[model samples]
Target: MMTGGLSETKSATPEIQDMVDEVKPQFEKKSNEKYDTFEAIEYKTQVVAGIIYYVKVHLGGDQYVHLKILKPLPHTGEPVELLDYQTGKTKDDEVTYF
Candidate 1:
């Protein structure tokens, strides 16, 4: 049986790091500050029309940045696209045990 869930990494791979580097300029432009490229707290890879890397980064001040990196298949040698970029503050929740 396979338990489907998000896989997390404390450290980033070269591919992920490269994607982050490429998108940093735009992210900084939009947010008016540099993104914390130190590490990725979590990530997921999805295979659709192409390969997609979903990464979550903590930018301090309760802010979290989510990035989606997409690459086309068949080796067209095209640049990867930052399909989606979003930021949100973390929320706290309480859990109850029964």
Candidate 2:
């Protein structure tokens, strides 16, 4: 699974960096616009039995991405899951572009 990135606390990680790299294009496509750059601001994780259940990333421009790491014990693979994408900049932050 995509097992690295956000920390239990508010900090950045290489895993999250990788996630950002992979998800950026999707975000742009979903938003129907392009961002010259993206800066992840904050993130929180939900864990169960010492394993991460999911991650929510707060990016610059008030964009947000929700990810969940899938499990199956692949011999060699990065297991990353994308649950949803959202643009919190809209009125009331209730709208999801994708």
Candidate 3:
């Protein structure tokens, strides 16, 4: 089974860095800062070396490990406050769960 695993990374030390650098300027010039760069996106994964890297870009959504950008999933349609049920903790408890 393909459990939900999606990690983003930005490493240009070998070559991707160079490519990102080259591409970012053009992208920024075209998009006019509507979105951040891959570097700004905070890449949290790693890519290997000695193999042709296959990068898949998503316009407004994201990508999965299998290089598939699944269609937009439906929202829960429930108010977040409805889910904030704590027995004793108050809303001002100074803790925010992700």
Clashing pairs in 3: 8-43, 8-44, 9-43, 12-17
**Superposition TM-score, candidate 2 onto the true structure:** 0.49
Model 1, range 3-90, lDDT digits (tens) per residue? 3333343346777777777876766777788755435555666666666667766676666677777776757777777777666634
For this target, which candidate reaches the highest lDDT against the unseen true structure?
Answer: 1
Say which candidate scores most in TM-score. 1
* lDDT (tens digit, per residue) of candidate 3 on 17-88: 443444444444554554442432122222222112222332333421111112222364421111111122
After superposing candidate 1, which stretches have Cα over 4 Å from the reference? 1-11, 36-38, 89-98
Q: Which runs in model 3 stand beyond 4 Å of their true positions?
A: 1-13, 34-37, 40-98
- Candidate 2, residues 1-98, lDDT tens digits: the string is 23443334445477666766566676667668776645443345543333342334555454655434333235546445454554444212322112
* Clashes within 3 Å, all models in order: 0, 4, 4
Candidate 2 or 1, higher lDDT? 1
How far in Å is the alpha carbon of 44 misplaced in model 3? 17
- Models 1 onward score TM values of 0.63, 0.49, 0.26
Candidate ordering by lDDT (highest first): 1, 2, 3
User: Measured by TM-score, how close is model 1 to the native structure?
Assistant: 0.63
> What is the lDDT of every predicted structure here?
0.61, 0.48, 0.29
